[model samples]
Target: MSQVVDDSRGGAGPFSRFEFLVAGRYLRARRKDAFISVIAALTLTGIAIGVATLIVVMSVMNGFRDELLSKILGLNGHFSAYPLEERLTDYKETVGAIEGVPGVRFAVPFVEGQALASGLTESTGVSARGIEFASVQKLDLLYKSAVMGSWDGWDEGNGVAIGSRLANRLGVSAGDIVTLVNPNGTLTPFGRTPQIRSYPVSVVFNLGMVEFDSFYLYMSMQAAQDYFKAYDDVLVEGAEPPDVLATDEEIDAAYQRVYRANAIEIFIDDPDDIATMRTRIQSQVTRPMTMTDWQQRNETFFSALQVERVVMFTILSMIILVAAFNIISSLVMLVKDKGRDIAVLRTMGATRGSIMRIFSMTGTAIGVAGTLIGLGLGLLIAANAETLRAFISNTLGVTLFPPEVFFLSTLPSKVNAGEVGLVVALSLSLSFLATLYPAWRAAQYEPVEALRYE
Candidate 1:
């Protein structure tokens, strides 16, 4: 009975410490088959490239998703409340009650209508939003983002705001007069007729999104009410008139007292809370109608992105699978070259299981080392993709991704821990699995046969 001197400095079990030693010896030993070393190096390089690409691609996807989400939510209110079919008579009271609801940040009565804006050179259809100018300023970040003019002018009658794209298309600047033509027009005793009015472009805003920048316009609630006659007359014949619509000026005065005087729109800070409030307000106040959040509005675009991501990931993973096969080939070649050494070890009392363990550990070492190197490289690239792009562009006079085509002006990347972890685990598992057959074949060799061949 030989005393097993604790070879491990920590007095750990013999098998535990010996496995590492065996793995190291096998890896360091020079072999005649230089092809095996080349194959192993290729395998490592393959894994590193695959991992790095996946990380960088996924990070870009995440950044795009985040950028679009912020732009959409930041431009549009989280939720809106409106009348179902009938115009709200007591909007102030309704908005007040809604303000008391949990998560209600701001509730402002808004009216939307389409009109053609004509400048000196061009005329384009635009979406006009009627809101409390001061309240809207607080809710919309665009007020602060104005490129020219002042948002304060929106408080005055006949004041309007236009996007930069629309301004350029119309060849107009701040203080320029633009004609607003409402196709639906106004109702009178004679008949419905188109209403054409002129308003000064009080402010010019630029939000960066092409669609919004090209079509969005803003006006004060008073100006909108006057232009659209949204508060004027009931369409019904001989219907019992409410105490409200007594006369034109009287009705306007009444609306001013009842609604505009005390009404203030509240915008909730949290997106989740805003969503909840929207749902609650719709259920309680508005009639059943299709409503969509900004995310859902662009579902197809987002869905396409997701599909692209999945396809890209699948394609990149094949590179790793190919590398795993390289690992298998290297191990097989190594086993063949060391046949005589394996036979001697067996004769010296090494079991087949121990032989298998040794080869498996060797394959695992290659995989783990490659994965760690890849992970570090991938993270570095993802963290500084923009800087890297800038450097490449400057040094080589070549752009990685040009800003003109891409919605974002620069390369965007956001590394997710979970995604990196998944890549690492996947590579390790594939490498371990690749070792099984080669290791098993080496272990199954008969000592006499292996010694005879050598």
Candidate 2:
């Protein structure tokens, strides 16, 4: 150990080289003080572990949220437009006007409703949608990634596309026939009759999201109108039996009132400006319209993810707090162990502030060293998180995450430098604070009192 008093004899500056050297010497415990060294080591280790864990966890959460946004928003429209009641009769003209609106990327007529899908071997509930294939094909998930299907033969009159998960459940494939039962069928003299239509499966797509892939079906707008009985909302459910048998003129008039499109799905130029786009386009159309953004539809789910991240960070920070307490304990014991030496220093003209500075530096040195080590370890683990997972799965024969359930094929991490800086400052601040009580206690010693005990 470097001898501070011997090497820096009569140093002029207060709390200068002599203080730092003595502080360094005190940190390396003597043989009899091995137990104090262990506690000091534990304090450093605890702080290190806490800081590293927090960094890795925050990065993973950020990556997870980003991944979810990309996958979910890739398939769904940014905003939806619809009338208050009856379907838009002039939807084709409306869609054209919407496309011209500022910030609007693409607009298309959409028909969607519930139906009972019956396959060769199974039957399930589905949200069948009528779509303009050209506009739908522009989506990245539908064309570039996440989905596996061809646009070929998809609007070939009455042909429909099914999701991969749904196809697997129904035991149906391309070119196979699937029947859809529409409960909102035509009413008859006896009673309301359900309508059924059989269509060929044109393709199978995978949306990657389990909820979407397992429950959504798509077909041409014409097929949806025919199969779903989509028409003008001109019929009163409880009218007085129509007073007579409906004639061709009355039927033609009512059929004309039926609009082919129930809603308009729109893609905005910038998804982030959805609210601004909504305001800009709301006045363009005279019809009573309701507009909803993707965020509005899924606020609860995303909010929960954000809340979990905050809670995890708060909980992990407590670990560092516990480590600070350990530092306090270690420093207090060091002060007690060096009471006689402290008196010697005081007798040799050391001021109370100088004594305090020496102990403070000792405690702070432990903190700085631990924080650096922890920072390096944390970043290493975060960068190699996926590799670690793969290694565990392969070497230990334990599967970490199943892609189907988790909606992600690999672990992701995105460290924010600002957050890391904040953590370092916090850890160092806490370490400095922990030294105050012990350092102050050391400076309070009276040379005569300490020497009498010695």
Candidate maximizing TM-score? 2
Please give the CA lDDT of all the candidate structures: 0.74, 0.82
Q: List the residue pairs that clash in candidate 1.
A: 105-266, 105-267, 105-268, 106-266, 106-267, 107-265, 107-266
lDDT measured at residue 12 in model 2 versus the true structure, 0 to 100: 60
Model 1 clashing-pair count: 7
For residues 1-454, could you state the per-residue lDDT of candidate 2 as single tens digits?
2354443444666557788778989998789889899999999999999889988888888877887787777767788887887567778888888888988878878788999998978999999988766766766676543244467655666788888888889889888988998877888998879888898887788756676678888888878877776765565444433335888766554443455788887888788887788888887876778988888988898889989988998999999899999999999999999999999988877778879999999999888888998899889988888899899999999888766766666777888898889888989999999999999999999999999956
lDDT of 1: 0.74
lDDT of 1 by residue, 1-454 (tens): 0111232222355344655676677777465656777788888888888888888888888887776666666656555444555456566667677667676666667667899999999899999978776566556566676898887656666778898888999999999999999977766798888999999988898776666678898888878866766664433443444475377754443343322221223455676554675677666654332344544567698889899988988998887899899889889988988888778767766678777877888887788878888888899999998898899899999877654456555666777889889888888999899999999998998899988845
TM-score of each predicted structure versus truth: 0.78, 0.81
**Most lDDT-accurate candidate:** 2
Return model 1's CA RMSD, one decimal. Answer: 5.4
